[model samples]
Target chain A: MKFKNNTVTLDATDLKILEALQKDARQTYTAIGKSLGMAHSTVYDRIKRMERQGIIKKYTTVIDAEKAGAKIITAIMTVFTDPKESENVAKKLCLAPQILEVYTSLSEELLIIAKVIAENQEGLHEFIACSVAPLPGVLRIRTSMITKKFKETQFSIADNSKVNIYKRNP
Target chain B: MNEKMASRILRTLSREKAFYFFTSIGNYTGESAASLRTFVDKIREMNLKSLEFHFYRGDFEKWIAEVLEDKELAEQIGTFRNSSPIGESLKNELYRILVRRYSKLKSMLY
Candidate 1:
């Protein structure tokens, strides 16, 4: 664990710890220490340090929606909005429970991209026709349904290797 | 238990028939045990979430009974599940049950 002002560089041990937590977030420090053959207090300190540095982000429980009886269809909706009202429309989209993610594109296009979920095809149709189409943006909408998700995982130790976080001053 | 039945119960299972621990649907802890020994080792190491999840779902007993072909151990786990012990207790007690029966079964092999 090597971190300075605004520079957080995790060593191999830290990455291994992160991997263990990613696999099972609820694992206690003692259990993690036993698994990795490290001290529990040391593990605790590392996790706390990562949390303070905003590297660890947050811990959350991942629910299986389909297994929980909520097998909703996911769609990536690209709503082209009036440049002035794009922010407004994006904020409004955040209010709906069906919207899983909402992001106002910062690129040239006045677009509000959102990851939306619906009960079924009919539900999605109703959502687009009733809720989205009537928005004040007053522009066309393009939706790309996500029929199959090949990979959907938060960037972890495995995915962060390509990042230059490990690179430091010469 | 009889010697023949004990042998069947104590016999090693294939990798395909191994039990996997899942805290929730699609949430795999990456902990799996192919045999009774490995199952005990996993039970000891498995996170509390997975322990509670499988205990409540009766998955432990189902695997033990069906895959391992240890009806007696399965019945023990089944009875234990019926008791509805909490997370830590479930792990400790379940481990005890499995270890006890496993030792007895091993002894019967000779």
Candidate 2:
């Protein structure tokens, strides 16, 4: 039904639709409707409502950077900056094309975790030297090269407990 | 196959303890999918220790460049990049390569 903190009310059918779309975003509305035993129009309406409510964010394609001729590198940097400068540093890091994911750790020190990509070892060195090392308030940078990957996936609607409306209804 | 060949194949498989199979749901029913499933099954039957298999989510070019470490093959696969559900063609190419490698390994053991 309704989320505790928000006004968005979603039912069983909505959850099913969300799961189906998560599995394959390219599926036609008609195809999704057929599987869910609902009309295509109903499927479209629900998706639109969810989008408006911000439950459904932007649809995107996830690329395997390592397979795309880029080496995956992760770095944990501890920034020694004034509290006001932290937000500015984050914004600057987000603007770099090589940076993929960025997050601030909860540790006492201002720890920033970032995932970056480069074509090779030399390219990686260049990125750290030119982009990351030069960023203001970046005190120390520790980097690890990802040699192999085991499992990577996008957010799964099937795994979300909030989307288990079918269980509650049934 | 001779015992020597069989032993060599076993040795190679033993040394290569892990495999990463990059694929997408787009080619779920293709021959490549079948081949990969079979390859995994074979590996499971061997009951080797420290072996791992990763089914990565992506197209063939990505797999070729990342897993196979073949720049030339990645370029060739890139030609089909614009194709919708690029996984189908990628699976086909990957199947061809895996089939050859697997067959050689199979012949030695059998």
Candidate 3:
């Protein structure tokens, strides 16, 4: 949609574009522009604006985490650190390249989750044992192998009716 | 909706006789935190009361902690850490309320 000063405003079209891009970030801007019935430059400008607004995060190549020799392991490591050590422990975990994401729990239980992609299972084990386990204040670590991937995807606006049990508005 | 009714709703949805819907939360083919928020917003707009999710993208515990300020929505969605997907229960009373408020699904349900 058109906006003031040639700046674009987000309308249903923009939302549709966002939804479509989120589903497949690799889609060309030209393709998106064609589908949206807008000029390629207009679409590019709108996307740039959205990125500046932190709405459209960076586009990523969906590499097969497994084929990349990196496994997306989910670990619920219970961090038993003092309240003061929380920040340090979190920082340590965050700094590890293997640890993609980390977050804390409301309760005393500090949840440590990561996607440990190593050269092999032994390498992954060594990283966890020497680097991760040796870290102070880590009370217990529980690891669950991703036996089968049922489904996985980033946030997108699309057919959520099947996803959400609740009935949604059109 | 209480747990039993929620379970019924899930069972009904899973039957997939007339409609088939599927969603999951993982780094691969499931919903993300932002997508979940959007879905919740849309469902709430339709005034849906009952919903269920199998959260496995990242750490549920951390996700829950981040949104403690939104206790109402958190309670509605129900978060579990290190728990199996099969154990989550449905809130059926909420479903009844949603059913009454969002009649649009009536046509879709059949």
Candidate 4:
């Protein structure tokens, strides 16, 4: 019942709507409403409100990377950099197209972590040596290669109708 | 896979056998594809509204399965249809799978 300011609080109906969308975002509003025995207009309004509140972000689909010819080696890299140059190193990592994600972490060590993907081992090596190692204040780099991914999922909209969420408090 | 099998999968079809894009039972979008390559392009540039209509109607799967006779592609589009998407995302996903299949079949020709 309680809510944080500007946060979108989802009711049971909202949760069910999110669940239906998670299954298939293109589910006709009428179909979803019919399944829930709610009016399609109501469903539409809820979805619109959710959109305005930013609870339901953009709709999307996941690609099978390998199937789509994006077969590559993914490495979670830990780069140690001088504290003064840490911010600069992270910025540089973000500009590299091969680096999908970059983060600055103080966990265990002051480090910059990046998710890097390369078409092959040679490309990966080239990136680390030419791109990463050449940066100023660069320290040692350790990479853990991802072998096989079992599962990847987006946000879980599940059995939590009873879970309390704060509504947008204007 | 033998060359003959690849040829069969990649062969061009006659006008009667080409896959046509339709918004409804009678209304055609004036776009038809005789090969996987053309099919991939048609899917890429076709009208989104018409594409969405045909998508939910299972027209794409039926044509791919029965006419193109490619069980793999038909099944791929079928599974995608079952887990449906709409709008631009739908177009992008459909194009992605179509291109992937087209590329694989193309590589087999060599």
Q: Report the interface RMSD that candidate 3 achieves against the true structure, in angstroms.
A: 14.9
TM-score of each: 0.52, 0.52, 0.47, 0.52
Q: What is the DockQ of each candidate?
A: 0.01, 0.01, 0.01, 0.01
Between prediction 2 and prediction 4, the one with superior lDDT is: 4
* Shift of residue B67 alpha carbon in model 1, Å: 62
Each candidate's lDDT (Cα)? Answer: 0.78, 0.55, 0.48, 0.77
Which parts of model 1 are misplaced by more than 4 Å?
Answer: A1-11, A106-108, A162-170, B1-110
Provide all candidates' interface root-mean-square deviations.
18.1, 17.5, 14.9, 25.7
lDDT of 4 by residue, A9-87 (tens): 5676887888899888999999999999999998999999888777887998788887998779888888888889999
Q: Candidate 3, residues B1-110: lDDT per residue as tens digits?
A: 34443333323211112111113111111112232223333333321111233233222222333432323334433433233333213233333333442243233344
Q: Using TM-score as the measure, name the better of candidate 2 and candidate 3.
A: 2
| Candidate 3 C-alpha lDDT tens digits along A16-36 | 678679777788989998887
Top candidate by lDDT: 1
Error of 1 at A70 (Å): 1.8
lDDT string for model 1 (A108-161, tens) is 777888898887866775566446655666365777778898888776665565
lDDT by residue for model 2 (A50-90), tens: 99888899888978655886545543333344455567777
Deviation in angstroms for A7 in model 2? 6.3
